[model samples]
Target: MKLTVVGGGSTYTPELIDGFARLRDTLPIEELVLVDPAAERLELVGGLARRIFARQGHPGRIVTTSDLDAGVEGADAVLLQLRVGGQAARQQDETWPLECGCVGQETTGAGGLAKALRTVPVVLDIAERVRRTNPNAWIIDFTNPVGIVTRALLQAGHKTVGLCNVAIGFQRKFAGLLGVSPADVHLDHVGLNHLTWETGVRLGGPEGENVLPKLLAEHGEAVADDLRLPRTIVDRLGVVPSYYLRYYYAHDEVVRELRTKPSRAAEVAEMERQLLTMYSDPALDEKPELLAQRGGAYYSEAAVDLAASLLGGGGSPYQVVNTYNKGTLPFLPDDAVIEVQAAIGSNGPSPLPVPAVDPLYAGLMANVTAYEDLALEAALRGGRDRVFRALLSHPLVGQYEYADALTDQLIAHNREHLAWA
Candidate 1:
C-alpha cells in the first residue's frame, strides 16, 4: 500500500509523514511519496523521512518529486496539506478582517471567504488527478477553510474528507481541567468548522448516564481560564464556546479586561519566525528525536491516540470527522459540511446525524451556515453582492452597517482572487 503527501513541502509535513511512517507496522504501508513544487524543502523533509526509516530499520521506500503527475501516479491515500497563496497571502487572509472592523480570523468570516477563493481551484484540480490516477484513493484535505473547501470538492464530485485538530484536542483539554478520564468524556458537537459548540457532555457507559452541571457553573471562569475563551463572550454568553474563541473574543470587553485578547498579528509572525529558525538551525536539527516529544505531554499523547485510531489494526468505532453535513444538523441545509462524530475506515468517512440541536446551538448553526455558504459563493460565484450578504449574516460582521462597507472594500480589494462572477 502506498500513501502520497501532496504539497509535502509544508512545515507540518514532517509531523504527518513521520507519524504515518510510524504506522507502517500496523497499516502495512509499503511506499511513501512526497510531492511539492518547492524542491529544496521537499528534499529536506524527504531526507528526514529517510533518516527516520533508517533508525527504525523499516522497509518502506521514500520517493520525492516536483512533478505532480509522477508523484500521484499510484497511491491508496493522498494527504493535501498545502497553503494556496503561501504565508504572505495567508497574512492577508488574517489581516483583511481586522481592516474591516471585524474579527480577523483565518478559518471564518471574510478571511475564510478570501481563503476559499484561492484554495478551491487547486483542490478541484487535485481531485481530478485522484480520479484519473488513483480512482479508489481517499483525499484527506487539511487545508484551511476546510468546511468551504470540502463542500467545493464534493460539489465538483470527488472523494475526500476534511480533518481538524480541534474537537479531540479541545476534549482532552477539558478533561484535564475537569479531572476526568479522557475516554469517559463524550460530547455532542454541531456547527461548521471553528464555530462548533458542545451541546452536552456526559460520562457513563453505553446504557448509563451522568451529566455534571457543576462543570460549567463557572461559565465565565471557564471562558476566562478553563477553556481560554475571550472575556467579551464569557461576559456575555457566560460560557466559553470552543472553536477559535480567541479570534472572536479578541475585541470583547471582558476579554480586554481579562487581558486575554487574541495574540497580536506581530506575535503570530514571531511564532512563525521561531518555527522556521528551529527548522533551519543545525543545533535544533541535531536533536531530531525531540520533535517526537515536541508538544506538551497531553497533546503528544492525543496525537498518538488519534493516529492509532485512524490507521492501527483491529477496526475501531468510526470517529466523527469533517464531511458534507448531509443531515448532521437538522437546522442547516443538507449540503453544508460540518465537523461532527463520524466513523472513519479504510473505505472513507461517514458523518453522523445529531438528531436535534438546542435553540442557542441552532442559532450558532445559522451563523456558521451563512459564513460557509457565502464562502462557497465567493469561490463558485465570485459576486461582490453575495460576499456582502455573507458578511452581513455573520454574527461578528452583522453587528453594524459599517460591516457592509468593510465587506465591499474587502470584495473589491480582493477581486482579482475571486472566481469570475
Candidate 2:
C-alpha cells in the first residue's frame, strides 16, 4: 500500500512526515510519496524521510516529487495538508473581515470565507488529481476550514474524509482530568469544527454513566488545562472547551462580560497599519525569530495517531471526524460536516450514529450555517451579494444596527483581498 502526502513542502510537513514514521510498526506501507510545488522544500522533507527510514532499518521507498499526478499514483491514502497562499494570505483573512464590522478571526466570520475562497479551488484540484491517479484511495484532508473544503469535495462527488484533532484532543484532556483513561471515555460531540459542544461524556470501563460533571466540579482548571483552550475563555464558556473557543466565544454573551470588546474597525485599521509598516520597513525582515526552537512533538503526534488509527493498530478509538449527519444530527443538515465518534481501519472511517442534538444547539447550528453558506456562495460565485448576505445573517450582526455601514466598509476594506472581478 502507498500513502501520499500533498503539500509536502509546508512548514508543518516535517512533523506530518514524522507522524507517519512514528507509526512504522503498525502500518507497513510499501512507499511514502511527498508531493509539493517547490523542489527545495521537497528535498528537505525527502532527506528527513530517508534518514527516518535508515534509522529504523526499513527498506520502504520514500519518493518526493513536484508532480501531483505521479505522486498519488497507486496510493491507498492521500493526506492533504497544504496552506494555500501562506502567511500573507492568512493576514488578509485575519484583517479584512474586521474592516466590515465582523469578527476578523481567520477561522470564523468573513475571515473564514476569505480563507475558503482561496483554499477550496486548490484543494479541489488536488482532489481531482487523487481521483484520476488513485481511484480507490481515501482522501484524508487535514486542511483548515476543513468543513468547507470537505463539503466542496463531496459536492464534486469525490470520496473523501475531513479529519480534525480538536474534539479528540479536548476529550482526551478531559479524560485525563477525571483520572480515567481515554479508552474508557465515550463522549457525544456535535456542531461544526471549532464551534462544538459535548452533550455527554460517559466514564468507567465501558458500562458506566457520565462522570464529566463530577470531574468538572472537582478539578475544573486541571481538566481545562488539557483542553488547550485559553483559560480566560474557558472561565466564561462554562465548559471544558476547545482552543478554537476564541471564535465561538467571541459571539457568547457571558464571554463578552469577561473580556473587553475590541472595535472591529480599530482592529482592522491597526492590522492594515502593521502590514504596511512591516512590508515597507526593511528592518522588519531582518528581525530575529522570536519563537524558541523545540522538537516537533505536537505537530508530529496528530498525523501519526491518525495513521495508526487508520491502520487499526489498537490505537486510541477512532474519533469520528468530518462527516455528514443525515439522522445523526438533528441540529445540522444531514450533509453538514459534524465530528462524531467512528471506527477507523485500513478500509477508512465509519461514523457512528448519534442521538438528536439539543434545541440550543440548533441555534448555534443555524448561526454557523449562515456563515458557511455565505462562504460557499462567495467562493463559487465571487460577488459582494453573498458576502453581504453572510454579514446580515451573522448572529452578532443582527444584534447591532450598523449592518449596512459595516457591510459597505468591509466590502471596501476587503476589496483588494477579494478575488471578485
Candidate 3:
C-alpha cells in the first residue's frame, strides 16, 4: 500500500518515519510520499526518512514532493499533519489567549478556536483534492484541533478518521504501571478529543476486569504528578483525565503559570531548529533522542495502527479514535465528533458502547461539544460574529469582555490566515 504524509517536512516526521520503518509488518507500505511546500525542511526530513527506512531494511520506496495532489494520487491513505501557518502562527495562538487571562493552548479555548478557523479551510481543500485524486483513500488527521478538523472532513463526506497520541500514550503508561503489554491494557477512554477521561482500565478486553481503581490505589501519586495535578484530585475524581484537561480544570492557575514560562511553541521552535540541524547529519539514521522532548510521543505507532486497520491490514481491532459520536454519548449530538475506543476496520471506526457518564464529566463534555459546534461554524462560515460567539461559548472564555477582547486579539494575530478578518 502507498501512504502520503502532507506535512512531511515537520520535525515530527522523523518520528513517524521511524515507526513506519519499525512497524513495516503492521502496515506494509510500498510507497511512502512526503508532501510539503517547504522545500528546505522537506529535504532535510525526507533524507532522514529514507535513511531510517533503509537502516531498518524496509523495502518500501520513499518519495518527497511539494505537490499535494501528485503526492496523494493513487495512495491508500493521506495523513494530514500540516500547520496552516507554521510555528509562528502557533506562537501567536499560544500567547494571544493568555493576554485575556485565559489558557493559551493550541487545541482548546480561544487559541484552539483560532487554530480551527485557520485550519479547517485548508484541510477541506486538501481533502477535496484527495477525494478527487484518490477517492478510496482514508484521510487520517493528526492535526491539532482534531475534533473540529475531523468534523470538517466527515461533513464534507471524505473518508476520514482522527488520530491522537493521548490514548496510546496513556495505554503505554498504564501498561508500564501494570506490568503488562500495552496491547493488553484497554482503556475505557471516553469524551471528546483532548477533553477525555479514562473512566476504566480493563485488561484482556473491553469485558475484562476493570483495574483503574487498582492503578489509582497503587500509582495515584505518580499519575497525578505526571499530570501536574495534586494526588488528592486524582483520588477524588477516580478517573484519569487527559493532560489537556488542565487547561479547563485549572484555567486561572494555568494562565498564571503560563505567564511565568516561555510559550511551548517557542520552546518547540528552538527544538525544531536543533532537530533539523541534527537531521542534516548524513550519519544520523534514526530519529534523534531530542525528538522525544519535541512531543507527539507514540504518534507514529497510533498512526500505523489506525492506517493498518483502515486498510484491512489486520491491525488492532479496537483502538481509540475520534469519529462521529452516533450516540455513543447520550448527552452529545449524534453528529458531534467524540474520542473513544472503537473497533477499527476498512469501513472506519465503530465506537464501542459506553456506560452512563457521571454528570460532572458529561456536563463538561456537553459544554465543550456545544462550543465546538460554534467553533466549527466559525471555521466553516468565516465572520467576526461567528468567531466571537464561539469564544463566548467556550467554558474558558464565557465572559463577554474576555471574549470580545480575545476575538480581536485572535483576528489581529491571524488576519492573514482568516479570510473574513
Number of the top candidate by TM-score? 3
Candidate 3: Cα lDDT at 220: 95
Candidate of highest lDDT: 3
Q: Tell me the whole-model lDDT of each prediction, alpha carbons only.
A: 0.64, 0.64, 0.94
TM-score to true structure, per model: 0.82, 0.79, 0.99
Residue pairs clashing in model 1 are 231-254, 231-255, 232-255, 318-343, 319-342, 320-341, 320-342
Model 2 residue runs over 4 Å out of place are: 204-208, 224-239, 251-317, 345-348, 396-420
Flag the better candidate by TM-score, 1 or 2.
1
What's the residue-level lDDT of 136 in candidate 1?
71
lDDT of candidate 3 at residue 28, scale 0 to 100:
96
Candidate 2 lDDT, 57-106, residue by residue in tens: 66688899999999999987788887676655666555544444545565
lDDT string for model 1 (1-421, tens) is 6778888776565566555556555555588788999887777667766766666667888899987867887786677777776766656666656654666555676666667777888788888977898787777777877788888887877777776666666566667767888676665655677777665555642222534344566344653674555455555553346646555545454234323444344455555455545556533322244443332223223233333345434433544367877766767788888888776665556765565766766776777777777767767766667767777777767755745776666665566665563
Candidate 3 ranges beyond 4 A from true positions = none
Candidate 3 lDDT over 1-421, as tens digits, reads 9999999999999999999999999999999999999999999999999999999999999999999989999999999999988999999989988877999988899989989999999999999999999899999999989999999999999999999999999999999999999989999999999999999999999999999999999999989989999999999999999999888778889999999999999999999999999999999999999999999999999999999999999689899999999989988999999999999999999999999999999999999999999999999898889999999999999999999999889999989998887
True-structure lDDT of candidate 1: 0.64
- Of the two candidates 2 and 3, the one with more favorable TM-score, higher being better, is 3
For candidate 3, what is the lDDT?
A: 0.94
Displacement of residue 223 (Cα, Å) in model 3 is: 0.4
